[model samples]
Target: MPATGEKVAALGHRYAILLSTFIGLLLISNIVAVKLISAGPLIVDGGVFLFPLVYIVGDVLAEVYGWKASRRAIITGFLLSALASLTIWVVQLSPAAPGWENQDAFEAVLGFVPRIVLASLTAFFVGQLVNAWVLVRLRERTSGRFLRTRLIGSTLIGQLVDTVVFCTIAFYGEISGWDFIGYVALGYAIKCLAEVVLLPVTTRVIARVRAAEAAAIL
Candidate 1:
């Protein structure tokens, strides 16, 4: 039989994979957020598709690994995002080769404004922490039953914070007041709908991860 320490180490290894996925989604979402996409009458930033996955992953972490682990992952993502933004800013400022003419394009894609970056990091930190914290509390209240309730409940609140904070900070002065309200309302609704739609998949992933962790101890 494996020692207690070994069992704990194995669990950490499994959690590390989830943590990596969470961070990858965050970094990619930030980069892609530069573009605004329209679907029918709804318009949203390009990150709309990818950013919600971070919260889904966070839900999994909280459900399977618990709040402490989720908190660590959230903080790590925050730091890494800051580092990524700083690195991109540095690269954007560096002089390009004499013949290189794509600097403008590159900046357009990756050159995040300082204000936007600040807004993203702040919103992400608050949103993810809220997700993890609320899920954990719900888990305790429900004694781990009704997975959908916790998932949807936490996501609703978390995404609301995320949408409001991010849009207000990033576009408050740039867009019209009505547009800002629309962005917040639309973004929150879309993100919550995504959680509801993906609930089955999220439940399966959580089950599989919990099973794997259980098997690791045996």
Candidate 2:
């Protein structure tokens, strides 16, 4: 429970929440992405469900908090993701307690895959920063008009980069041919579609966050 006026580092209370939300979602997405699932005809990772929301919150951060703040959050997420992978790897190496039979299950679920981690970290860092930068630049150029254009456009470009980086590093050798291409194509399209579909909700969240930040400042 955050007490009234509680603050974390330089970010004020209200803004800190957004940063925390972004990092939390990023970490969870990576962990759950191991399972491949079928959503109608589209086959995707478990992360696909939660990961798009990562971008929605990211949009809020960029649109409401500005580039410097958004960049700080992005860097934080990247570093913490590496730390998580390291921690998981170390845990896997540690000798299990005698008679602990769940080690296999634990490893199966949470084992640290270096390639996947590298790909996720690289893609997230690049994708999110690109998302933030594009939004901020568009905001500046348009003087903040056309909110839908900014959100969806940035997501299109950012998701594209993210999908490419992640698929290449994580699955390039493991999955070849059209499977690789479809993996990238489907993930990218779904991510972009999520942004476009949720534009209204995203815009409202941004507005509300902006208002809250303004109120907190007073």
Largest lDDT belongs to which candidate? 1
lDDT by residue for model 2 (1-218), tens:
44344333324766778889988988898889889898788788889778999999999989988999989999998999899999999999999999998899989999888888889989999999999999999999999999998898899999999999999998899999998998899888888988788888999998887776665555
TM-score for all models, in order of appearance: 0.93, 0.91
lDDT of 1 at 161: 87
Instruction: For candidate 2, list the clashing residue pairs, or say none.
Output: none
State in Å the error of residue 95, model 2. 0.2
**Off by more than 4 A, model 2:** 1-11
Point to the candidate with the largest TM-score.
Answer: 1
Worst lDDT 10-window in candidate 1: 175-184
Give the per-residue Cα lDDT of candidate 1 at 157.
88
**What's the CA error at residue 116 for candidate 1, in Å?**
1.1
lDDT per residue for candidate 1 within 19-73, as digits (tens), equals 9999999999988888988788876788888888898999999999898899999
Q: What is the C-alpha lDDT of each candidate?
A: 0.90, 0.88
Colliding residue pairs in candidate 1: none
For all candidates, the clash counts are 0, 0
